[model samples]
Target: MKRKLLGVLLALALVTGLAPTVQAKTVPAGQTVGTVLFYVTDKAGERVLVSQVPVSEMVSDLKAGKVDNTLHNYSILDRYVTTVHQEAKGFTIPEFVTYAKEKSAQAALRAMELTFAGQDAIRLWEIDQTGFDDLDTYTCDELYGVARYNYPLLYKYWDYRTQEYADPDGKLTRDQAVSEILKSAEPEVPLLSVLAFSQRYMITDGKYGTGDYNMESLWYTSGLMDSERTPRFMKPMTKEDLTGKASTAADSRYWVATLLLNMKDAPEVTALGAVGVPSAVMTEDGANYYVRFSCPTQGAAIYYNHNLISPSYTPTSRYTGDAVVIPKTNFPGGTVTMTCRAVKDGWTDAGVQTLTLTSSGAEKGWISPYKDVTAGVWSYEAVGYVTQNKIMGGTAKTDFSPNAPMTRAALALALYHMAGSPKVSSGTGFADVPSGASYASAVAWASQNGVVNGTASGGFSPEAGITREQLAAMFYRYAKNVAKTDLTVSRDLSVYTDYADAGSWAKEGLSWAVGAGLVNGTSATELSPKGPATRAQTAAMLQRLGLFVG
Candidate 1:
């Protein structure tokens, strides 16, 4: 059983690896601004930048670099660089670069706009390009361009008030220059806000690409990836994007979205119920132990580890059912704790449950080979014991015929085995008991031992069906003759409604059986002693008589 369970877990693991792969991060379509993106090439290199470029172009540039190893920097006008360096796996860089650039640019731009307002602001732009061209050597080409273009207006105004090419005591800082460039290069189309960023490159179908940029995708990817690999860029979604179509499992953004939507409403396992007796007598058939449990919501399935006592058991999607049957052999006679949980797609686990099981050691002998005697039947244990003890054999190799009536010959043979199959003192005692008959010696031994007697006309009716009262009388005689125990008068027979109808010869045995808790009346008041005994009833009675004791 343990080996079989292990095989199933390995199979599930293989299947999971073959299932569809989902991207860890996704980017929405269209232009985005004020968003910090990480451009990375494996563990060797990465760059942090705030870009106003369309998401599609950004992905294309990154992939091109990944292909050729010569990824060029994007146009500086549309992007603000925070830092440039290689980052090893599992390391995270600071996010202050984009923030600093945005703040510095906004401050410088605001200062310039206020200083050159009214009629002078128009005059401030009249300066020529000669003096500004030299400023190119002092900065990056993109930054120089922005500063150069704005330098003319500032120079003309300063000259009108102080007669100089620049402020001698107040040179523009780098932040101020970058700020001017940003203000002048602002795109005509409004930049979309960035909602989220990916910490790792998105790979799909053996090809790398950026997927949809939305909160659903953002949350989905976030839920799927570990904290170290989670995307860094995130922006709130607009009201319109919030009302977009729902995502499915096939979508990269689905899992995270589903997790967020259903987390709180996930089902919980309310209780676990074991189906039968906690302990069972181990047999050759290897009867299984069972458990039943339920969850609060529909579509929920139960998962459990087969080994109830192993501390290292890893829970997988191998076993699924509201009720599970575990082989008794796998768990020997001791306590075993079965761990279980309720799970479903799109919901959090309901948490684990533990069920304890107890089992007895294997019993010896030839157990019935019948398949019809299933576990949990009332007479199952008794039948197993009786068959294994060799007191009686099944009607055929594969059937016990437990519901069939027990004949006098069968009872005689069963008792004969119980008494160790002793040899008969004489050939045959009754006229009907023949020497060649299968139960001939059994009847002879039973008669000589005073366990049974012949009917009228000195004939042993071996083929006749034995009645409940007659069976009790035979058991009482055997107990006295073989077991050396006399019947005790414990309970009053008056409690039975049919007690008065019981024959004088059967009263003592019936009283003994009822007192020992070996037999019961058909109802609270009726003994029904004259009724024929079925195979199942006989097995039950034999078990109560301690046929398989010890």
Candidate 2:
């Protein structure tokens, strides 16, 4: 019986390539020690090998129950041994080896854990087992590792943010969610360091839906009463009803609409300066035009016109930049013709276009067309409505000089006109201006509007030519509500990298203008702030400040 058992064990070992050694015993008839191999797997699933002794030696150990004792230390062999005993004839050697390697509690536990993790585990396996160096090649699990181990919490957050029956308040508090996600990670992993991995795995803000409307609504609600205090990216605000904050109904919506425009699709085309009626775009037949009136000065009316040929407001889109297209049914031939004439209160023009059709004409999508010519040849159709409505021309000229260098006093006059040419009290005792100066009322109004202050002690330098850099500063202050009337105090202009040598006269304003992207230097690092202002640069800066644009 001993010989028979030894012979059976030897045969099994020889066929399975398991244990090679056995005490001198009957071996399988055609099998040799060289044919048998015994391998095991570590807890990590790494292959390891036991002794590869002969089948006769293996049987001797088995008879003494030494193989069983060996398997005790290497538990992976225990089950395989039992299987071998039950079906020794059909047991495959590779199967025996695989069973032996999967011998530890750690290995079994890991396998069980992986099973629970499901797809996450598979993703982990593919990433970890692969030898690729590129991070993109890693599976989500390989990328996230233990960080993604908790399936239940992940599911919970997913459910909370989605599904009809989800918990309303259970949306993972930022802390709760981040904490749970971090806990599953390895000790060495940095918190939030795995963002790329999360992105890779489509975790968190992945395929799951966005946050609830209630949460999104918080952006609009933080300062619901105070339009000035509202944060960006908030929900839509209702009309001008005071939200306990000093705000007009128009204030919150404009910003909210801007935010919505940026987030939902493209950037929004927003009107700057002063917001006015025609809140929405008007359509004529198949064409569309968005028009709004804004005041750059106290009494001025500035109209903005945008066509619907292509509606976009993002930097990447066409409508967001400086380029503008004025829609026309036909160029020179159609109802529109170029003509030189006196138009708008303060300006006359050499080149202007007049439209035969009005907004009520059969040719749809038409508004009254006009042109600008005084300063040089430039299109004024966009500004026609606003300029025509208000007397844009100064006292002497019926023509508006589009390219003329503005003076401190000229700007003051323009601003006064913007403010509806309000009656001036005068006699404020400006040391520089005589009591009868032409711009005294305008200067006084400017002081009232906080657009400017005197250049010297109670003296308005109305005749000083405005430099590009200085105008940049003036517009900046006007927009920011800083200059009292024109007496913008001069500061050392060293703050700007481009205009380090700017003259004292325009230095402070130049610094602010360059900083605000209002001016690009003439050279690599020279602002030449004292240089005369050009029509185009002035227009561009004013446009940036929500002032007049052409």
Candidate 3:
């Protein structure tokens, strides 16, 4: 066929000639920040990755004259990271693959099919070779413009009619050289397939996209591969199921979201309650991996008691909610599969997705409202104790937001839940803790019982995050006033290097907490009294306070 850019590559070798120096291009819209690794062949015949020339700095590397994309000899891969569980029961492959297939599947494919292919990538490299100072000096569009304006010199300097260059060497013909260079551009196995397949199958589909090689236009993906890494997009579905051979694939940001479930919350006993909505339903901005994905991102509705793992379609379930509940009777062996579909309003729903919940560390099998509270995590058991006993609940439907700062409102809520959500007979004098607010009764009960007090200006900074010493003081009062526990516990705060940083009033509480094994310094020597306390830290302290189960 037409090795169109091949001649341009040959012509550019001797050109000190007429390519215009173009001004810089503005940054493209909706560009995402991510890593794309490039590998070059080493003297050992292995493709050794050039460390700094790869991820995190490639764009800067190009701009700094540290790397070259002047030719297509480099094999590059765009990476998207995900985690996996060692056990087959919690494997994450299905979850990630489901994301790619359901969320933004064919939409990106269609748009890219019309404009992107392997030769487009080749032309990008060829344009860079024009030697107007490489990508360091000009943008991809500027390079393309330079080529568009100057590269047709191929017609003037070379003879396509004679099947040879105007200055061809006797040692090589045009066809032989074109074939060799094209072969070199075909990198390793999978990469070769990507390029050749694009040429043989998809070259004529579309061209003239935005011309921004810095992540505009379209890019190629390996396509969805089944078990053997065979392209599932290739070959027609057989008399049975098949890939149904076809053309090029697009890399999309429209992949579906997934649930990062709390394994400890898996059911074991009589009845596991409806857990919580997923905290990690999707990736990046919570709705899209790509900024252009379907908007007003939505959650999914789970259909459980279906008893099937991978159903052909959405099932008619006995129940539907944000989370799944399986009784010990239905989940006899500690494993139950449920189906889910996205509740996306204007977009396509991810049809019958199968998810499984399994039994965790012990027989009590407490199902939590927080997906962040999982087995093996540092505060797992502590979070379990508080959540199981109703001392704490999620800040959101399914998220504990463990790393988030612990606010006074959350503290009040937890202490109230610990008090069995008692009805408040009187009001808290603090103006901020309104009578109608959710934590009103908790603050009221705690205030009446001397478990807490109003801050300066007669107001509670309910939304403000608390320092570590403040957490110690409030829980200490709860221990003394509400729980009416012994107040004799004490420790030498001087042992900690930062002990003097604690406020005088909080020293008693901090000492008591340290003595009672309810709180530990952030490090062995530093008691970060003024440092912000996170919800996770509070959970651990609460668990050790003898306020709930050990």
On lDDT, the candidate that comes out on top is 1
**Over 4 Å off in model 2, which ranges?**
1-386, 389-391, 394-398, 420-428, 448-450, 456-458, 482-497, 503-526, 534-550
Error of 2 at 483 (Å): 11
Model 3 regions lying over 4 Å from their true place: 1-362, 547-550
Residue 288 deviation, candidate 3, in Å? 40
lDDT of 2 by residue, 1-550 (tens): 0111111122343324332333332212221111122222224332222212222322333344433321100000111111111001111122222322232112221132111111221100010111112321222233234321111222223222221123325665645654553343222110100000000011133324432211211222332222121111111111111111111111111111100000112112221122222111212333322222222232122212121221121011111122223244433222222111111111111111121322333323223322334322333432332344352442234444556666777766655665568887765356776668877887776776666767655577777867665576566556455323322112223322445556565565564454333455565334577677643344444444332221
207-301 per-residue lDDT for model 3 (tens digits): 11222111111112222211111011111111111011111121111111111111112211111112133211211211112100111222222
lDDT of each: 0.41, 0.31, 0.39
What pairs collide in candidate 3? 99-256, 104-254, 114-206, 234-245, 235-244, 235-245, 236-244, 236-245, 237-242, 237-244
Candidate 2, position 494, lDDT: 34
Residue-pair clashes per candidate, as listed? 15, 47, 10
Q: Which regions of candidate 1 fall more than 4 Å away from where they truly are?
A: 1-367, 547-550
Question: By TM-score, is 2 or 3 better?
Answer: 3
